[model samples]
Target: MSDADTARRALALLDLTDLADVATADGARDLCRRAVSGPVPVAAVCLWPRFVAVARQALGDSPVRIATVVNFPEGDTPIAPAIRETEEALEAGADEIDFVLPWRAVLAGQLTTAGAMIRNVKMRCGDKLLKVILESGEYPDLDKVRVASELAIAAGADFIKTSTGKTARSASIPAARAMLGVIGMTARPIGLKPSGGIRTLADAKSYLALADAMMGPDWATPATFRFGASGLYTALIEEIGGAAPGAPPRGSY
Candidate 1:
């Protein structure tokens, strides 16, 4: 594909994010503005739960969906609190929930606990989309990543996200490949999101290419694929020949 076409496709699949510790209502509004200013509207804006309402009001009736993180960068939040968090975010008009799967629990061989957490939060989410963050960077090997991906998919995650962008390591191509392998095996229509460290058109193209090679060229649509990053918007805007509002606010993805 030409650069313009690639940028346009990537832009449509982006989850323009602002999960920075310093995020504010004004910042959320600004992110929302950027979301619509692009050549094509982004699939969603992923922000902290507190700003779900702010994003909702800012986005108005725009097609850009509002997504908020539950259990967050750290996946240690108890199942009960995670469910409550999902409830409140949905009440605040969040159309999607990007939840942190308890990776540590999975690493410790507590698959049941981790699975239950996903299942419970998904129940709370009801008809809304749920993107489960695996924090794959923390895994010891691709095997572990595959195991976690299987658990999340079986437990009803609408999408399996790669990282939280808060750790020493974030999303990587190898990690994404392993996750996609699992996604391809499933009969369910699960999606893949490779977040963090993806800040340029080249990075976006690489991931898009991988998804196409693994799942087929037509598989990576806004509904089935997403690039979750804040800084990536700038690169896409530059490629598409539009003035970016400004540098995207610093964020943990």
Candidate 2:
């Protein structure tokens, strides 16, 4: 495909994210406005939980979904609070929940806690999409990464994401390959979201190509695949034709 075609496809799979600590209502509104203003709108807008309502209101019936994080960059919180956060985000009109997997517990051999957390949140998530972030860079090895992926999928995550973007080593090709391997083995319909440090079109294409090689060409649609990124949007914008008007500064997460 030409660069423009590749970019258009990438744009459709993007989750234009703004999870910065300083992110405000005006920022969320601005993101929402810019997201839909483009010729091809992105799949969703991923942001802090508190801004879900603002994004939802700003989007105002556009196809762009609202996604918010819970147990966020730190996944140490117990299940109850995470569930409460999920409930509140849903109430605030978030269409998707990206919850940080309790990787600390998983690494410590508290596998059951990780599974239980996912199950509890899955119950509350109901039909809404639930993305479980493994924070892959923290895992010492690929085997642990696959183990975490299985636990999340078994516990009912609609998508298994690679990172929270706050970690020094957020997303990587090897880690994404392992996650995609796990997803390909499952009969259930699960998705892959390789987030963090995916800035350029080439970076986005690497993840997209790996998904095609591992899963199947038809598998990585907006429903089955997404790029959890902020910097990528501007790159896609450039690829599509022009830069977004009033583009927000891209952040690490």
Best by TM-score: 1
lDDT of 2 by residue, 151-185 (tens): 99999999999999998998999999999889889
Pairs clashing within candidate 2:
none
TM for candidate 2 is 0.98
Tell me how far the alpha carbon of residue 230 in candidate 1 is from the true structure, in angstroms, after superposition.
0.8
Give the clash count for each candidate: 0, 0
Whole-model alpha-carbon lDDT for candidate 1:
0.93
How far is 180's C-alpha from truth in model 1 (Å)? Answer: 0.9
Instruction: For candidate 2, give the lDDT.
Output: 0.90
Per-residue accuracy of model 1 over 5-107 as CA lDDT, tens digit each: 9999999999999999999999999999999988899999999999999999999999999999999889999888889999999999999999999999999
Candidate 2 off by > 4 Å = none
